[model samples]
Target chain A: MGAGLTLRLRNELSEIRRLTAALDAFAEDEAIPSDVAMRMALVLDELLTNTIEYGYPDEVPGEIGIEAKRDGDMLMISVTDDARPFDPRKAPRPDLEQSVEDRRVGGLGLHLINTMADVDYARINGRNLVTLRLLVTSDGDGDPVAVAT
Target chain B: MSDAGNQVQATIGSEWVDDVLVLKPSGRVDSNNAGSAEAMILGQVDGGAQRIVLDMAELDYVSSAGLRVLLVTAKRLRQTGGRMALCQLRPNVHEVLEVSGFLAILTVCDGREAAIGEVTKT
Candidate 1:
């Protein structure tokens, strides 16, 4: 498997299916575990869905970019979109343990992404950029490289 | 139509057995079609079907958008004195539910028979 892969898709919800398939083939070639790959897919899917669904003001033509690479046993992933300058990392955490009646439906996506992966976000040059890193090794015995925003 | 993203277009099937409503949602449920999944389930709830069972044996993937649908549907059913049970989650979907602490709140069974029993039990 190559050390890096870049994917560009239009800012549309339909693009997520393509994204997941590419991720699946990459994970298979790289020999990443199914569980780990699913986690990675989950976080990225949530973030990208948010960007595609709510990022733009209308059906304006735009693009989102994803770059994933393996650094040692860690998987480094970054997603960039030229939508609104929103920072997902700073989003408020949802109450996970709240009673079902009191719980809200929509906020869990960001919460799940934050819980499953180490994420950092930045708005640079009028773009929304989010970076995520995951430990792909089963032993879970490596120090995570800090991503500077 | 095939999606460039390799996601199968989501499809939802429903059946009624006795007093329970059973939903079979196949393919990926993400932002693209979670609304359809939610609408199907909530529509049953709105139609006064109390006991609900989701047969997820063929469900290959689920994202946070999908999870939200399940949570919201479960909550809505509970408010109306209805019960919802899920069965046959794929490994990936199971893991997502587990990591999100959904196992604690949702009634999940090992198979369709168990799910039907759980939801239909007195």
Candidate 2:
């Protein structure tokens, strides 16, 4: 397997399953901690879900790209899509303490993405690119079972 | 209730005992399917199921979308004098709830019996 992995999928909520599967396979190959893998699965799922659900105004299909590589103690992941420009960093934080009746269902995904990983956004050449960095450590299991693609 | 070869399959199971509705959702809950979950649970609640308990022992994963559904269900129940409880969450799901502060506000118990007990306490 290459030291880095890249994947592209159509912009649709159903495609998140494929993205998450690929991420888990990479994490297993790299022997990342289970908790770390779970977190990354979540962050990427949210990011891609957002791009698919809200990124396009015309309800047209678009392509979304994801790349991940292990960098020492950090696993850097990037997602690029042709969706409209929306910076998640500037999105308002969900007031988690609000009463259940007052809480809105739609805003928590962005909040989780911001809370779980270090994220950066850039709009370059008419595409929305999101970069997320997560701190990862091996589970210290000696027999690392690296799976092949 | 599953996602992929690597992710848990998403499934929602339910049981009715006495006057309470117990739902067991397994696998991943995200933007892809959260609306269905919300609709199903709230539909039951709107149909006049006053007491609900979510047995989460087999739940492998949950995102904010799932959390939103739970919170909305609970709030809806409260408005109609209904009650809801959650129990036996997997560590990751529990962690998400904790970080989001849902653990503090929602009724969480250790097991199905406890959750049912909590919901029926009144």
Candidate 3:
């Protein structure tokens, strides 16, 4: 594993295409398992989509960066945004038990990332940084098992 | 050709499978195109589509934005006394819906026939 890939993105809806391509390439290069890779891509999509939608107010033309790396048995993803100081870590989980009429889309995205990975968030020097630790090729334990590419 | 990869695309092929409106969405649905996708599906509901089956056999990707389309459509159908079912979801898509707890509210079937059956049942 060399230097991981980073994507420089704008706070635009179309930027999701570039973000998806970057995640696909990162998953392919890292030899990540299919299921884990799928979750990774979708969760990363949720992150970028939320940022692009709510991060920039008054058309701030926000600059966002995403870096994907393999750290031991974990595939680490860091998303940094020069937007508002919202921390995804503090987001409340939506009631999954709610009925159809009661369900709301307010917090489903954060609920998803929490379900899929170990998440960390911080506001460093005006940028919101969210770090996600995703498991890779684990044998149900914390240990990494060999997976053929 | 480079611009091709930068553009977001998703296909929603609509057909009537015997009084049941079937919409097949393929490719990716993200923030870039979720609103249009929502309209494409909601159009049927507004046009008096009583029973709709979302044939998701070809859909490969959906983010939270895409899920919002389904959720809103589902809520609309419920309000209008219409019915909808989803079938042929790829494993990843299935997992995403399940994680969002949509499987409990919306109908999910193993195949198109079953989905059609679910929406048509009075």
Which candidate has the highest lDDT of all?
Answer: 1
Candidate 1 residue lDDT tens string, A81-130: 89988788777987767767877777777877888889888888988889
Error of 3 at B96 (Å): 0.5
Q: Each model's C-alpha lDDT?
A: 0.83, 0.82, 0.82
Q: Which ten residues in a row have the lowest lDDT in candidate 1 chain B?
A: B1-10
The lDDT, on a scale of 0 to 1, for candidate 3 is 0.82
Interface RMSD of each: 4.5, 5.1, 4.9
Specify the highest-DockQ model's number.
3
- Sorting all predicted structures by DockQ, with the top scorer first, yields 3, 1, 2
Output DockQ, candidate 3. 0.40
Error of 2 at A11 (Å): 1.0
Candidate 3: list runs displaced more than 4 Å: A138-149, B1-9
Query: Candidate 1 DockQ category?
Result: acceptable
Query: Second chain TM-score per prediction?
Result: 0.90, 0.90, 0.90
Residue A116 displacement in candidate 3 (angstroms):
1.1
DockQ per model, Cα? 0.39, 0.37, 0.40
Write the residue-wise lDDT of candidate 3 on B1-122 in tens digits: 12223544457999998899999998877666777788788877898998999988888777787888998998898899989999988877888888889999889999999999898887
